[model samples]
Target: MTGAPLLRVRDLNVRIPTPGGELHAVRGVNFDLNPGEVLGLVGESGSGKSVTLRALLRLHRPPIVMSGEVEYGGQNLLKMSEARLRSVRGSQISMIFQEPMSALNPVLTVGEQIGENLREHTALRGRAAQDRAAELLDLTGIPSPRARLADYPHQFSGGMRQRAMIAIALASEPRLLLADEPTTALDVTIQDQILRLLLRLRDELGMGLILVTHDLGVVAQTCDRVAVMYGGRLVETAGVHELFRAPKHAYTLGLLQSLPGAGAQRQPLQPIPGGPPNLRALPPGCPFAPRCAHVTDECRAAEPPLREVAPGRLSACIHFDELPALRTELQEVHA
Candidate 1:
């Protein structure tokens, strides 16, 4: 993190028109990703993790308003023209979407899909593109990749489809990859395989990655840093081990408590009380104030700003200092 960041996001806000009103999907999100760093975005469903990731590439179409400075390599991606953005999309900053089954074209062969990317970004064409596609597939650990190139999306298993998605994303050798729940649809073993494969590829290519997932276990295993998002905002961020060992935010502590421990086989999981707030009409103060056990009268007066509470850690909580003692108390209760 000493060198200049590969990607810098500042004051990112996304709004989507909804029947209820304009849904504030992402709210003033900001983060920096250094080269070769893996930053995990962990949150419950509807927490805007995916939206924020997509905003990096300006992927959303009309009716969705995005305001932010997504600077990469000293260029503002948010202000880039559509044609310019298209050139940057798969070549510089690629994305592996949540579900490959839907993302992959049903009518096209895997090789054709891959060749399209190669044609768009790289100079490889026809037979050359096809050969490169096979190489990419083999790199992803798919057996007989050359033969699989002829297969359709339906012909591949769920795990293989996800691998194919990864292969397609890597066709252009992007410097930054945005993976949205890449392993969500696979079995436990396949999930592990995918995570390991992603890590290996990141190391091999020296690429920065942003992984979006609800699973804390995945973040713990793969990410260098973890950003916990809630109610369309980042609630806490820190180094992976530091955040796990001693969470600084009430919401983060609640999330850790909800995870099932290895020692407590029969112990009931302590679910976070209440649900995420309604983004359409978020509470005036801290969005998590209603569900936070550490909530104070001051917490409901105005939203707490996300700020550094310690070295390499950020938290949006007026009571962040009390969390360590509260964590110990939660452990005793679970014990």
Candidate 2:
């Protein structure tokens, strides 16, 4: 499973329309997913983590433009026929959406939704499908799955709905799972349980997972690698341990500094100053320059491409060398 990449995305760009203008939601994002690998896409809201992953499944609707290579199984998914794309989705690659209630059909029962996936992708049908749905629910640690199959989405708690979503995503026994904040609305204990459940499922099924979330703690607990996203672009990427130990990009450092647990006792949380840039009108140069403490003339002059600063590590900052000093300062300030 680890010999070759299961999915490779290169130079991916996604644009969406708004009343104001076309917003560049994702800009030249690139990543490789190997079987059994858990990669965390860490970024604040609207940082394009979800948008970038959604492109792999062609989940966006019209007025949306996506370009570049999404190579899976020797084919470019971005260029595949819609019918072919549909065949791949769920069957080979499944998504556990952000919000369970919205992702699960409100009108459908939990069993029906899970059974639908089994019917569409697998050979299961009728009684077998119904029984499998209950088993799937059980697999996800849902209690009394047989009794709950008839329950609607609204009848379940946030955590239960998320588990149901995971069970449905697993129906096809997909090789890849794109989980978009599967634990977003769940409490801490439930979130931990869901994360563990996913890890267990991944090990059992040997599927690669791209977990899109803003939580560094979650990334630390669940991912093998972590990609840090900023204004529609990757600011840095590293092994999960390497990233948390020593981040290279300013944005990555800022995110760590903002973590309450990352600071000393009595240290105030040092939230990253300013807001993310508006995608519709991104800076002509580095998108994060406006909010960066180390911005320079060169930074505002042009955008920096994500380049390797070390083996197995990439950063998209013009002044990345200065980041260590700045990181220390921020740590001291928070301390």
Instruction: Give per-model CA RMSD.
Output: 2.9, 3.1
List candidate 1 segments past 4 Å from native. 264-266, 325-335
**Residue-wise lDDT of candidate 1 within 183-252, one digit each (tens)?**
9968989998999999999999999999999988888788999999999999899998788888989999
Q: How many steric clashes between backbone atoms does each model show?
A: 0, 0
Model 2 Cα lDDT, one tens digit per residue, 1-335: 34769999999999988889889999999889888999999899999999998988988888799999999999999999999998999999999999988889999999999998999999999999999999999999999999999999999999999999999999999999999999897889999999999999999998999999998778878899999999988889888777777788888988887776544444577888899999998887898888888888998999999999988999998877776632333233222
What is the total number of backbone clashes in candidate 1? 0
Cα TM-score per model: 0.96, 0.94
What is the Å distance of residue 67 in model 1 from its true position? 0.4
Error of 1 at 163 (Å): 0.2
Candidate 1 Cα deviation (angstroms), residue 7: 0.3
